[model samples]
Target chain A: MTPPDRRRRALLLAGLSVAGLPLAAWALKPVRERPRLIIVGGGFGGAACARQLRYLMPAADITLVEPRAQFFTGPSTNAALASVCAEGDIVRGPAALEALGIRWIREAATALDPVARRLRLASGTVLDADRVVLSPGVAMRWDRIAGLDATTSERMPHAWLGDAQVSRLRERIESLRDGATIAISAPANPYRCPPGPYERASLLAWRLSARRLKRCKILLLDAKDDFTKRALFQVGWDTLYPGMVEWVPHAKGGEVLEVDARRNTLRLQNGSRLRVDLASVVPPQRAADIAVAGDLVDESGWCPVNPASFESTRHAGIHVIGDACIAQPMPKSAFSANSQAKLVALAIAAQFAGGPAPVPRLVNTCYSLLAPDYGISVGGLYGVVSDRLSTLNDGMSPLGAARELRAREAAYAHEWYEQITRDTFG
Target chain B: MHRLAVLALACLLLATPTTRAQDSLSLSCAVCHGARNAPSTVPSFYGMSTAQIESALRDFRSGAREGTAMPRLAKAMSDDEIRALAYEFGAPVR
Candidate 1:
């Protein structure tokens, strides 16, 4: 071979090796090279945030912590009890998370050490991360109700979260024969699932109307002067099972003072004793004793958060969202919690990127199943105001329209649920 | 050549204003609500009452109104922006 030919071959080989260098480095690079983000509760909020995180910032690592293997969203959960919708319709798997490379811890978080930025899990494994999100939904304040606790919930079934308690209430509805008087006792504001009790009543009515339409009446006792979707609930009641549901607002001594779940009776603030075949009880709610015990909540039993980022006011690097956080104008719904999760995720991303948090756009929609084909919904947008969340005016459709409108809304309501479930765990 | 193309793309991105996050969103209000014949879907904001804006903001903020992404975007705007945007959006063009 000539000298020039050998020299050209050597230069070609050097160029080829230089080209292969980047490919070798890329092949050897680790998958989890980016920053790690740990999100608690893979329900609407956590899951949505995780999903949106992929769109906004795909390079970050997100780990979602949830005790449940599958998520059952509340958006369409009310329809399950009413027989208007099926439970499977609301249940969604981890396909959405898997797409975004979101790792999962299949257990609840027992404790959080914000200072160390470590999340202690129930399985004794520890998750140490750059950011920790706690969206552990809301728990009942049993102390507010003199005789009710977690055990009592087993019998009465808040059924707000649509789990074991939800099925328990449905079973009770099935067992009760004609002319059975069922009482739905509701807790005060900031409770998880604000429209849950009414939705349960609607479903129970759906069951009753199937067999004995006019024979049974479900009395809904409330602690608020008026309630979420009151007009919608009223319209549905009027159309589906007229005179079958009685709604007592808070002003009329509707605030629950005591409950005897064993006997299926309610003791109101007044000296009134009401006996019923089945009583579904929703006790007052505060932050989970976990956050409160850990000094996460303020005096109001809720963790105050900067609505924009959902970051803890008392602690940095820790974000609180879902029903446990104080969102004044935003109702403590699963949708609201899910939206807050995305905002928090962005805020965490901004922090990781060493930049100020980009203001977020949050959305929420609540659908109620009034009858088999009747549904009503209210959806809105949310914003951060003075370190808290407030709703934009006229963002939601007024609930409880005319009979025809209610039924039409119900059809749309099912679609809304399916869309939200996809947004969460789809 | 690839590196130069990448550099060119980056420069283009740098050249394009990243549109101010919030306050600047109002700049487009003129495009929609300004002098041109407003589309049917576009509601007239010119000469709109403040009470009307407050009412509208309340609806957008809370999800009482439906069918648009306005609530989420409107909620993010400060009350002052809502007021200012309302006034500016409502102002009659000279």
Candidate 2:
């Protein structure tokens, strides 16, 4: 037999004792030989899956492959950019997962072979597993925008991924002179954190106001005509910072055509040019390169999956979650990713237990901070309907809620960050 | 011998109903309510009676109790799901 066939035979033998062997002998084998599971990426989805799987299957061999030692969460990076929290506050390391007996490989996953259930690392090492769960988040489509490749991205940071780009944009905002014009380019639908750009605009305006910089203008150039929680966000903006922020929607020439990074100028779709002191352009996005290289993504540039199991429709024995997968009616937020990861973990655990997949009931709640003391939230419960994930019930925070209610939500938002980060990282 | 082994494994899963219930819907509660003894603003129902838990959820669903997100979340759950969740999470801490 060939080498791979031999390996498969050996694994099968290891998984089940010989047909005539005594049941006692089969039961006595070390539990460590039970199964091998590998998880890619260490963000909310990946880490939460690792933690939940470790809880459900104590003896399964679990390994997490993440190149970065520290992970900066995208959920609260807006607060850090607005100076409400320090940049260090949003950072978490894998030491907690390591302490829980999870093996952490600090190397990039260069490629994946879905049929073989094997992953190749940057150091030319191949890791094979019984199952692989990928949560490699979104990657910016730099080619879609002119004059906004990797080099120009440094000068005009998108700050979408909660990396050094956040600090780059923060520095620009801090150094702005009074009456300076700051332009923020919002991307079209199906991006990470739908309410993120609006929240960023609100917090940055608060920051500028705190600095007592009078007449500073924030131009919110949105590519889409409508946004999530539009009326609520507009009401908050009007109440908090009157005449300081202007939102230009797609119909009003809000679509960004190109950027002259050197001159700090943006060319809108209506053939109008606006020069600004600082520009934060959030570009369109797609699944990360690893998914594309593995042939996991379809024509839509996002991975399609069986919503019940989150197992890739393109490949068996591999599941894709988080921003990389198309889970409609569930916005790509940290809460949604965490929810999807838990369901995936339980589905895998059910498989190991020799039971049918559990009926899936997913939930998500996203909290956006308008100011440090003001917050709004949108929440939903989802289930599979007609083979698609559909929202069962959903609602957003009430419009014109009392000040005390908004403040309570603000406190709950902070507590949510703390609890979610702890639950995921630990 | 393989058939006998499979039979024994099947017998071992006698409590599969409760395990299945615990594995699905209740797992989502940890994102906010969190595990027992963890610091969270959301209330924990670890030691509460299952009846109490069920009543609260029903109240939220019926609009008898006002909440920021719970009412909407509770509306999605059926009576059976509510009982499963309450029984799973409301079991007294051993």
Could you give candidate 2's per-residue lDDT for residues A1-426 as a string of tens digits?
136755665666656665554444333232334678999988998999888888887888899998988856899888998899998999986668988889999998989999988899999999998889999999999887788888898888888886789888888888998899989889988899999999999998889999987699999998999999899889999988998889999999998889999999999988899999999999998999889988899998899999999999999889999999999989998888888888898888777665567788888899999899999999999999999999999999999799888888988899888888877886
lDDT of 1 by residue, A60-144 (tens): 7778887787655666565665555566666675555876677877877888877767778888998777667777777677788
Report how far off residue A44 is in candidate 1 (Å).
0.7
Candidate 2's C-alpha runs over 4 A off are A1-33, B1-21, B91-94
- Indicate the DockQ of the complex predicted as candidate 1: 0.06
Q: Which segments of model 1 are wrong by more than 4 Å?
A: A1-33, A54-59, A93-96, A386-388, A395-404, B1-94
Candidate 2: which pairs clash?
A: none
DockQ of each: 0.06, 0.62
Whole-model alpha-carbon lDDT for candidate 2: 0.86
